[model samples]
Target: MAEQGAAERGPDGLSRRRLLAASAAGGAVWLLRGTVGPESARAIGTAPVLPGGLVPYQQVYENWAGEIRTSPLWVCAPDSPQQVADLADWAAANGWRLRAQGQRHGWAPFTVAAGTPADTRVLLVDTTRSLTALSLASGFGGAGGRAVRAQTGASLEDLLAFLADQGLGVAACPAPGDLTVGGALAVGGHGTAVPAAGETPRPGQGFGSLSNQVLSLTAVVHDASAGRYVLRTFDRSEADAAAFLVHLGRAFLTEVVLRAAPDTRLRCLSRVDVPATELFAAPGSPAAGGGRTFADFLASTGRVEAIWFAFTDHPWLKTWQPAPDKPLFAHEVSAPYNYPFSDNLPQPVAELAGQLVSGSEQLAPVFGQLQFLITKIGLTGDVTDLLLAPGLLRSLLSGDTLTHLLAGGLRSDLWGASRHLLQYVRPTTLRVTANGYAIHCRRSDVQWVVSRFASSYQQVLATHQARGEYPMNGAAEIRVTGLDDPVACGVPGAQPPLLSALRPHADHPEWDTAVWLDLLTLPGTPGLHAFYREIEQELLGLFDGTRAGLRVEWSKGWAYTTDAAWADPAVLGRTVPATLRAPGAPGWDEAVATLDGYDPARVFGNPFLDALLR
Candidate 1:
């Protein structure tokens, strides 16, 4: 998760705090006792050797959050691309489903549904171990430009480390480094970034989500020319290839050649003093949003996020700007995961969590405040040390310091390569469910979008609070990004991501940006389902899909009805498909048809996919 603000609350930041808290509570506590592995092992007998050889299939397969568990018949760790192809062929032929898993950092069940029967004959293909092949070149296969050829199993952390060595980097990536290239691309994972004011868009480099950077991908799709499933490479320009770029795990990906750029230094700064009403004021409203509004920050830097706690006024606003050189207040760091308090649960939050676990769900409200208090106070201390250690006079940082320091509330400036700055979050971040949405609008309309959302969310939370139900335990995280660019893929006429929240909207030709929103909280809170549904209803009512439209983040939880994720038969069956296949969504239908034709057997289909696609 993007710890700068996503704290399990959304893409990353405090949304991650909810996750880290769940994980920190104790790994064993979350696991379903005497379930998952033993049952499967007893039924399946000894695991069988498959095309790529087997790894004994000893452990119970669990998602990163420990939410989903399964006992697979085999854990195939293929050593080469051919082995992966062979396994796919075998799975298709034997009527067995193949679920690919990398870091399993996401909550979505793209690989396998959580409650799939233990007795079912499913094979778990662990790509992170053996399929990690990477290579860098000045000019690569698809675009004849700078690129890196990496196996799907290669983690984003490793990919960036390799790029760092080669003096290259991408526009943006998910906050956590533990994600595999395959998993991140499958759902079109992204970071919050866009072109700054007066800046021209760059060729072969997109300030959009990570999926836009894919020049070409090699996957195990059924080739009509061949009698069985085989390794096939599709250039970004091909209409059918659009589906693979962000197919939500409907297809199996092996490797990709991603566009790259010469690395640049960045300055990441944080501030937590802006009042919510002023920062997210509605259009034409006299809310007197203090200093620079959220839009103003984006106009200058084009990369920023605000983490507004559920019940707190001050948001932990963070802005990352391009800095060619280190500044006096900037801390020089080479690696990521710099926030130790966030990485590990602090004592107070831990104790409160312990209490919450022991039938004190009323403490949920206190939990939210503690999250804000700890982050506010802890981050302030860190920034104070950064400001003080350099002998910068404390009195110089007086009233309205955020105004004079930097337009974005400069608490502390972290100077490092963009990759390092982007990934300071650990994998243990969020194990709880988080709901997310992306609103498509122009950069100028960002505040209107944010304000509308904030006002509505406040009302819903207030309603729940009146009923003594604190469903939201974290921040309603906000982030921004541009629509995915077709040119960056090096496809002569590539299309944008079909399901990307930032996909260019036909009705809003002037709207080139997307506003990401998320509210994070601990799992198992009473009335969480009903609470989430109300928020969903409120967001849908406000955005309304005309000049402003709505879409769900692929990786996080969504389609809430009764605290259950991907529930709501209407949403699962109708809304998602209709939205993704909205008017002007280039090649969306062709992409689906191509995938369907390739996997006529529907081997990748899960209950979620079948329902949505039906």
Candidate 2:
């Protein structure tokens, strides 16, 4: 990776992108620009005055899992939308390419990639600083929720916290709060929500990925009339707006209006007694399991997630239900990241991961079982609050709270606001490489999807274990979501997000639900890539390319090879495009063409994106 000072000019030796990565120190002020620390190898050329101060590129960029690394020419942090427009225009006028970097939490190369030098004239836009704006609409009369406007750089945690203060909440959100709005939407990040048992979706929003809530977005695009890159707002009503809605990072969004609802109280329960064989049984297997099956939970609550520890019989099942008020036996919480055992990486687990990554590949199973035991203890230990330390709990309450603990009449249910409970895992917690896929199928077929996939997953793992190739480190996650409704955009004639994993199946309208499946393992673990490839093959094999199919969870790892992620040429060049171009699915070629029209010079693209869009 190349390192250099900020460019005072464009690629033609002028100030195009005053790119500067945001510093963790002294956030909002952003007065002291990032100077070239010891890592930067080159100095940026001479430049004119830019909005953000020019300094050497000193930031060392690493993805969340520390799997990918790259040094960009400059980390440009624009203070305003106008500044962004100017920088983009100048970059195009020259020959430099720009890639936006949010929290640097994602595995994909959408922003910047390893082995790419900074001197290649590429700029990484750090939006976390000045771009943190969150505003709510006022003076509107409607049955729907309020429309909130947020900048692309706002972290989900900050955005969620602000919304909590405003008495508003979102439909669904990923677990980590450190995820940036731009990065999340660029990759269609989602959480579990499927209309929660007859609850109607708001007029201006739907129960899908974070992207479906978008009403209008502003981005820097080439304007022939203006003869330069300028800030342009696209409403859902426009045809081309569909392209920007989910352009796979091919286009950039500065700010967007997201529809939000009044905050609601939620109850979350953790169940760890269900066996994998019964919980994930075939769609119509049998009713003899005695206990409720995964399908039963989905039908009853509509919000369920199954996290099965590899090689373990009882997978942890989490079910969330709408509780208008505190239940008789509910525990109360006011903040997030409540799961201490998960939010902060455990020392033993970290050691296991270190060993697994260091070449003790056979220890994968042992590490996974240990993790499962810790989770069980985390949920049911003497202090059920998993997070509350013994000393702190005793200090908070000396008598009644302590006596109740002794009596064993402690609470059984967790009661908290949606925002607080929905966001429990903090960033840098349990950093590991993972593969994710969302399978769209009929709600009735969810059991089949889960059962079949689980069966195939276990079979593959066992076959590999026989060959001494321990590829799994324990748990797999399963979640569900409703298809994105077109009307959610609030545009008179808008369509659903073109590339969202929850996008509907055109032919079989009954296929409106999606089952999200994910496989997790320690990064750099031997045989992980090949192991994930086998799982990917199993998932794709079960879909059959008809009424049911699979879409990659873009923000996460995918396109697996024997040794690395995003390295499968066939999956990139053919599988993804062909799947998107299926009979019922919308036009892939058309979306690519529309995006190309938006930025003729490919200003916001990279080699990986070019392959997918091409």
Tens digits of per-residue lDDT, candidate 2, 550-590, equal 98988777898888888899998888776666584556777
Q: Write down the TM-score of every candidate.
A: 0.87, 0.87
Residue-level lDDT for 528 in candidate 1: 73
For each candidate, the alpha-carbon lDDT, in order, equals 0.71, 0.72
- lDDT tens readout by residue for model 1, 43-123: 455455577444445445656655565653355678888877787788788877777878877877777776565556677
For every candidate structure, what is the RMSD over all alpha carbons to the true structure, in angstroms? Answer: 7.3, 8.1
How far does residue 67 in candidate 2 sit from its true spot (Å)? 1.0
Q: Give the residue spans of candidate 1 off by over 4 A.
A: 1-22, 25-46, 71-73, 138-145, 201-203, 382-411, 583-587
Clashes of each: 23, 16
